[model samples]
Target: MSMFAHTETNARSRLPGGKALGGLLQRLGLGGRGLVIAIPTLWLLLFFLIPFLVVAKISLSEAAIARPPYLPIWEWDDGLLNINLNFGNYLFLLEDPLYLSAYLESIKIAGISTLIALLIGYPMAYLIARSPENQRNILLMLVVLPFWTSFLLRVYAWIGFLKANGIINNFLLWTGIIDEPLIMLQTDFAVYVGIVYSYLPFMILPLYANLVKLDQSYIEASADLGARPVTTFLTVTLPLSASGIIAGCMLVFIPAVGEFVIPALLGGPDTLMIGRVLWDEFFSNRDWPIASAVAIVMLFVLVIPIMMLRKAQAVEEGAS
Candidate 1:
């Protein structure tokens, strides 16, 4: 659903060449490839595409708050169908600063958290990638193993650590780091920490995948050419792993933009993200039209970058 909503990426098909391409000519319907292609496509069209179209229609309509509410795109009047698809929901967003600020803050939080995740995750991924062959699998497994447990449980664990009376402060006070427990829990800092911690593995995996493929010869060659370590990194290593970076950024940023769980649980009263706003409107206020409008706006934002990342990956794959 997110993929379809990205508006940023266009789904592309790759065809094999030479004998493989000729084979397609002979057996276009071979095996269950026909169904393999058809079923998911049909499912996406039926479920995702149609639902999104309905939401888009709603976003273009007025916010009708009546019971069993629907903001219709048009109405029947004077024995003719009149198009009343005014952008009231979107216009309201422009008139009010609160909604605009929340959306901007959501993007800022997500972007910064993604950078933080990458900063921490990259060194770990690099270390793991450079480990001995025998130990690498175990290390990689440890990174992924946390996913087997409930995510909610993991976030809940942070509560006990970040809360005012949490164990972390108790230990810190016991050690005399400060006379008082710091105000961490239920703040932006806590939210940032939680997000980075939770999303670290997602950032690490792609980086590891790319790093594992990076030949030491590249570094050796650069060093042998008298390039400084930092110079080599800038000129060679980073550029080579661009695809992985792009992929990881997309994976983290896309979901983080709409994350309600982390902010609602860990964030304080000041945390006003678009995801929370969307949830409030749709479920709490039962303002479906406004909620749908928010969703469309988010979809529009994600469209360009996600598509660019996909295109970059395609180019990288072609080069490989």
Candidate 2:
């Protein structure tokens, strides 16, 4: 064969293999993208969606002594779908003063705690953000270093500090500040302390993230125009950090509203949070349907704040 014919033969032989390799690579790329999407979707379906569906189903059910502990609302009868939903669980929540009070008190506690967290966190975050470049990382690390310890351990430690005979009371007594140990443990005061300590970082981190990126030129410009520090903060820094404020407040408030651990551990016997109620109904009373109803109602209550946060974030992104 001539040189040109030999070259043509070699080209034809390689064409199919090249095409196959390209097809394989394309298939792998598509598969990788699909896998990335599938993993999170599957995880949410399993953990969140399915669990919520189960809770919803249970909420519509009736209390029973049977194996699963609740009577099903749906049944198949005569080739038709039969539905028997007992809405009394939801209605009962409205009729019961206990439920109403618990919800209101939870809102109050969460709101107060969030406000306190913001007041405390904003300063800490601002200071951290304004620190020297080399020291900023160390300050941030110190803020987050508490997470290195177990949360349960931290809360337990607070118990030792807040108890009547705890270190704080003893120190105060020794210093002649009081005749006896002041009542601190198992009170609303203790609950607030535990919550603030536990969630302060949540409030600070978001504020820091926002403040660190703030343009210092605005402050300088405001000062140049005869704006006082407080005025500058109110008009410039505060407005710019509104997104962080919203984010931090949401992080603190949402979880605080449904908080079980802190209130259960530190709050008084009269402390009636919705979370504690839900826990009692589920475990103590074994009334799963009522617990589910409470949970569903809580979710409905939270939807408003969640939407507000989403809207704020969207607006911030748009402004940026």
Candidate 3:
């Protein structure tokens, strides 16, 4: 036996069930390395894959109010090793214009929010990248500090700051800016602020990491070639930092599409985000089938952007 396999067999012998499995693997010459990989693969299949499959199965079933979900999901007529499925929930999804519009709006909002984060984060990242190493750590820490707080707590804090009788309104009133408090909280403005604040760290870190690795020589080389700042940035800096921009945008945009807390806390009733709608379907209505359909749709919606980001990142990496 190989040293590695021998070592793994000896170690596995100390454990209970592992000894038998390890001996079998040793006989098959897949003792350590294969087991290490197989264990995680099996774990993911059990925990993640099985749950997701269950949800998908439930999504395809008719809406039910009963206590238990069945094995076949659609019809549990057959005792075992049998299944029945339907597409009624997805058809219902097709008929709902409100749900469709919410999905589109969610995409637009996430896209715009990600762009805003990129615009703001890029400069701060650049500054941090250019800073002295000692100072860079401090600046990066400051950028990351807010992330230490609970995400829901941050959204709640926005409520206190943007509410009619809250900090901003009170300050404005005290300064005689208005006769009454502005209705800022539970508005789109509040939603945007909450989204931006919650996701800023995700935006900044990737950009900072990417920008810091970039040599100063490129920028200096462009300057030496008589390229103006704007020209150099457009030609060189932007292209080089393309991966960072893509990374940061994806990190924020994907989650923001499915964001429930910020919208629930900071948005008006009029702002009908899909996340809130999905939440209501599962919790308030107890409609698991429709909820599953919503989840499947959300998953489908997210796949497009994720694919786009992955393609962009791969291209950027290839170019680098």
Tell me the RMSD of model 1 versus the true structure: 10.4
Taken over the whole model, the C-alpha lDDT of each candidate is 0.85, 0.91, 0.85
| Candidate number with the higher TM-score (1 or 2) | 2
lDDT of 1 by residue, 238-312 (tens): 998888888788778888888898898999989988899999899988888889888998888889768967876
- Predict model 2's lDDT versus the native: 0.91
Per-model TM-score, in order, reads 0.85, 0.87, 0.87
Worst 10 residues of 2 by lDDT: 311-320
Angstrom error at residue 18, model 1: 39
Q: Where is the poorest 10-residue window by lDDT in model 3? A: 68-77
Tens-digit per-residue lDDT, 1-320, candidate 2: 69999999889787868667756866877455776888899999999899998999999999999888999898888998889999989999999999999999999999999999999999999999999999999999998999778888899899999999999999999999999999999999888898899999999998898899899999999999999999999999999999889988888899999999999988989989999999999999999999999999999999988987787667656655
For 1-320, candidate 3 gives per-residue lDDT tens digits of 59999999788777889767768878997778877888899999999999988888888777654675322453334564445677888888889897898898788778888888888899999999999999999999999998997877878888889988999989999999999998998887778888888999999998888888888899999999999999998999999888888888998999999989888989999887889889998889888888888998999999977987787678656656
What C-alpha lDDT, on a 0 to 100 scale, does residue 72 get in candidate 1?
A: 59
Cα shift from native, residue 6, model 1 (Å) = 47
